[model samples]
Target chain A: MNLLLLSPDDLRADGSAVVEDRRLQHMLQVQRVEPGQQLRAGLLGGLMGQATVQQLDSHQAHLTLLLDQPPPAKLPLTLVLALPRPKMLKRTLQTIAAMGVQRLVLVNSFRVEKSFWQTPWLQEDSIREQLLLGLEQACDTVLPEVILEKRFKPFVEDRLPALAAANLKLVAHPGEHPECPRALGEQPLTLAIGPEGGWIPYEVELLRKADFAPVQLGPRILRVETAVPALIARLY
Target chain B: MNLLLLSPDDLRADGSAVVEDRRLQHMLQVQRVEPGQQLRAGLLGGLMGQATVQQLDSHQAHLTLLLDQPPPAKLPLTLVLALPRPKMLKRTLQTIAAMGVQRLVLVNSFRVEKSFWQTPWLQEDSIREQLLLGLEQACDTVLPEVILEKRFKPFVEDRLPALAAANLKLVAHPGEHPECPRALGEQPLTLAIGPEGGWIPYEVELLRKADFAPVQLGPRILRVETAVPALIARLY
Candidate 1:
């Protein structure tokens, strides 16, 4: 883990801290951290800091935390993806976290199989594990907000507009006019990618009306997992 | 499987065939083949064809073969990658095959752990299995040639010039001038991507001198697996 993420409840007074259990095992075994060395640590939804080792044991580690500043601001991007297979969903979340995305909305698509919604990875704890992997890779601590929407119409008609307001919104679809822009700089954006068979015509039209401009990633059809990296690389 | 790949020895003079064993299991059980159904099939290192089911039994399936024209030419691209971890190496090879790449040269990089080179995935037969997966995905049978260069200095100094002749060579590096092109049409191109932590400064400079343009995919640092898809999406 790049930054050991801890909740505010886990902190003790006097800037002294104790880390035990899984996170501690990861630090001691996977990272092979040594006593007298410093490691990056942070609050789950708060600022990051450097922690100096005070004591080390097989079961726990005590450290002195030097909290100073909050983590870097997240990308002004919110992604709305048609839920893919469970394996892919995990990887996409990690990738999104690594890219500094802080909000995700998973929705159902016509091409999405009903069976996919039953995957265990969609459970809150499972989802959080994948996000943590991404945060560690990016050296950040803040966990992104994740929401699940089963009905497409209600989300598009009732909720999407509020999110799209004041942001450049783009939806990735094949065969659209005016290619997707190459860079967005510091501006916030909301990008939507459809399921394997792509957004159905009606869905695309609704998204377009809701201010989502259609974009393409070229002619060859890419798998959904591959498409995630391809779109994020271009948009971010 | 998009294409059923077969060896040359499996072809019959009468153009009738019997497919048994692992492939038979996949066709009969996984794909649920039925009489009169047609599937895309190809001869390894040869032409692609259409196969029609004539009969089926518990052990084997009988087919009528109609060999047709060769597949469309592969993209004229050469990939130079730092040898990835064994698990990732397997998938990467499969992706390369599916995309119809013609050549791959695995090189040494600072961030590439020496242990990675010793992976069993590099065994000839294992590598072929990964390539077959790619071929099946693309409905094509042509296999990309694989090369391994353990020594960095000798290969870069001697072989790189001939490899880059008459081709656009680009290196996928972060924080570089002139970001990776979004599209390059059908030009013969050479693309390079680094290992987990990326190539050291000297390695990147060596590639630049060999006429490889250094490029970035914006500010987000993508994992090598993700970067491969992004690079291919931009190029092919």
Candidate 2:
């Protein structure tokens, strides 16, 4: 982990923290941290700074934190993604968090399998765990908000108008469309990416009607995990 | 598999072919092919077109090939990457191939663990398997050329200068460098990405001497897998 993340509960009143969970194990093993050594650290949903190892052992690591710096700015973007399968969902969650996405809407598309909705990875704790891993990877403290929309038509027709209004609404589709824009200069954007086989004609039309301009990334179709970063880099 | 890839051995002199492998199983189970069904197919290192199913059974599928169209144009880019861990290596290979990277050099770096070079994933057959999967994912027929550089300094000093000559040689480092360029319309580029912790100062200097201009991707640190696509999308 690039950053050692500590929750609010880990902090004592004196600003000292004792970590005894997986973070402790990671510090001891992967990081090979020792007493008196300082490492980059951040509090969950709070500030980021450094922590000095006061005491260390196999069971726990006592640290004195100096959380003075604000977390990195999140991307001014909202991602609307067709819920991927369970296996891909886990990695995509981490990827989204690491890439500084501010908001995410996991929406349903015609091609999304009904069984995908039943995955335990969608549980709050599971999602939080993956997001934490991503935050640690990117050394960021802020968590992105994730919204689930199981119904396609209602979400797009009823909610997406206001949700996408005033933003550069884009839907990444593969066809005869303009290339995805570049260097958009901090404009707020809402980008929708479809499932593996892609959004059906009806879904695309609904998105189009919702004001999402269809954009292409040339001919080579990339997986959602690959496409997310590519699109984000291009737009931002 | 988007495009069923056929090798030379799979084709018959009569322009028909029989396949009894994983591709056949995918055609039978995932694609659910029947007689007279046409699917997108491509010949390895050759043309891409349609394959009409002439016969099908549990053991094999026979098809008549009409290879005509050329594969998608490859990105005019060569990637120089520090060897990632085995798991990341597998995904990175697929990502490189899917994104149409024409050439790759997996090189050593100060932060790269020595064991990474020992991974079975570095084996020729294993690497080819992952590349094929990437090609299949992107529906492309051409395979990327992969080069392994176990020693860092020798390759960068003696060879990389000539290799990166005349191309836009860039080394992606997170620092006070200019942002990576965008949409340089078909200009060839050679991009170097370091390991997780990044290239040490000496290595960066060596690369600088070799004429690789340092570039940054903002403050947020991305995993190599994420960075590859992000950089490629931005450059091309």
> For candidate 1, lDDT tens digit of each residue in A36-128?
999887777777888888888998888888877778678788889999988889888888887788689999888888998999999999999
Off by over 4 Å in 1: A40-42, A47-50, A64-76, A152-181, A184-190, A196-219, B5-24, B38-58, B61-76, B166-170, B173-181, B186-189, B201-220, B234-236
> Number of clashes in every candidate structure?
0, 0
DockQ of each: 0.33, 0.86
lDDT of 2 at A153: 99
TM-score of chain A of each: 0.94, 0.98
Candidate number with greatest TM-score: 2
Tell me each candidate's RMSD, in Å, in order.
3.9, 1.1
Off by over 4 Å in 2: none
